[model samples]
Target: MSKTILYARVSTADQTLDHQKAQAEASGFVIDEVVADHGVSGVSTTLRERLEGKRLYDKLRHGDTLVVRWVDRLGRNYQDVTDTIRHFMRQGVVIKTVVNGMTFDGATQDPMREAVRDALIAFMAATAQAQAEATKEAQRAGIKAAKHAGGKYRGKKPSFSRNTFQVVKEQLDIGQGASAIAKLTGISRQAVLRIRKDPSLADEALKRWGE
Candidate 1:
């Protein structure tokens, strides 16, 4: 019998992984194991890079079933998300999402079914990518507007700690994009971009805030 695995992700400390698992259970999935990535954003981090996510890659075998709350939990960008799905499909693993209960199985040999499945995957992946872009754009615009209002923009307190900031700096030094850093560190992309733009400013703020 194929094992059923549940993968859950929460981008911030506020989100709870247990809730995601509960949601999956409520959706009637008989999850055999749970793999969770806490304080990890789905917008840019590769599946293989996440702690539990990487384990999932190694633990999953052919004919396994992977369940997620939604496609966005798998990935944010279209290419990355689709590639991950395709990889599992090729491994003879079945992918299913709890939200809409969509399933992708490689066992199907019908060309028309395959085409339809591919189309759905493309549409979902594109939608996820667009949403992430829109969110980042909105954050940028909000910050810009706040800046335009003069000294009223004191800025939100940094969500990350000193160690996290150091990690962000290391990722930046390695030429990682703001989005990728944000996803990996669980910080907002806007914050990652700000840190990338001015590491000194971020450092000063962290010190001032005593983070």
Candidate 2:
């Protein structure tokens, strides 16, 4: 029988595999199994380089469905994401995302459909990579700014942690409401609005406060 497996990557202490699993279930996915990689950097490590990620390649059979929170969970960058998705699609595995409920099926034989699917995959992969790069750049800039300010910087500490901010940002990116993101991340709605307004500033605040 074909199975539906949810893959989660937890890169920080604030991120939990259980939370990801819960998110998947809440998104209406009836997952048969959960596979995860802890403390893995999605931007720095390829999927195959991860221990559990490798298991995904071996355990998943044709006709099985692979579910992720986002396309970023599948690979390290645009190229890696596209390649990994194509590899799985070639094996007849259907890839789905919990965020937008995107479904990519390789079982179709129509040329036009295939072209559209391929284009969508490329766009999503590129978007994921671009977001990752932008976040990294923001972090670096934050660190540099903090170092330059040195002891003179006395910025107010952020009400949210790095992980909480990330969660809020992800939800906001998917068009979630500020109140919803605040409830989900256990922060104030105002804080979520602040982050939504200027994510880079929020990130810099965390870094400046040494969070």
lDDT, candidate 1, equals 0.83
Q: How well does candidate 1 match the true structure, expressed as C-alpha RMSD?
A: 8.3
Summed backbone clashes in each candidate are 0, 0
Candidate 1's displacement at residue 178, Å, is 27
Off by over 4 Å in 2: 152-211
lDDT of 1 by residue, 131-194 (tens): 8899889888888897798734445567788998999999989999877787798876656766
Report how far off residue 140 is in candidate 2 (Å): 1.2
Instruction: Please give the range of 10 consecutive residues that has the lowest summed lDDT in model 1.
Output: 150-159
Q: Give candidate 1 regions above 4 Å deviation.
A: 151-211
lDDT of 2 by residue, 1-211 (tens): 9999999887653455667788889998899999987657888899999989989899899999999988988865998899999999999999999889999988989999999999999999999889888988887777679779784443557879998988888899899997678678887666776787789998888987887
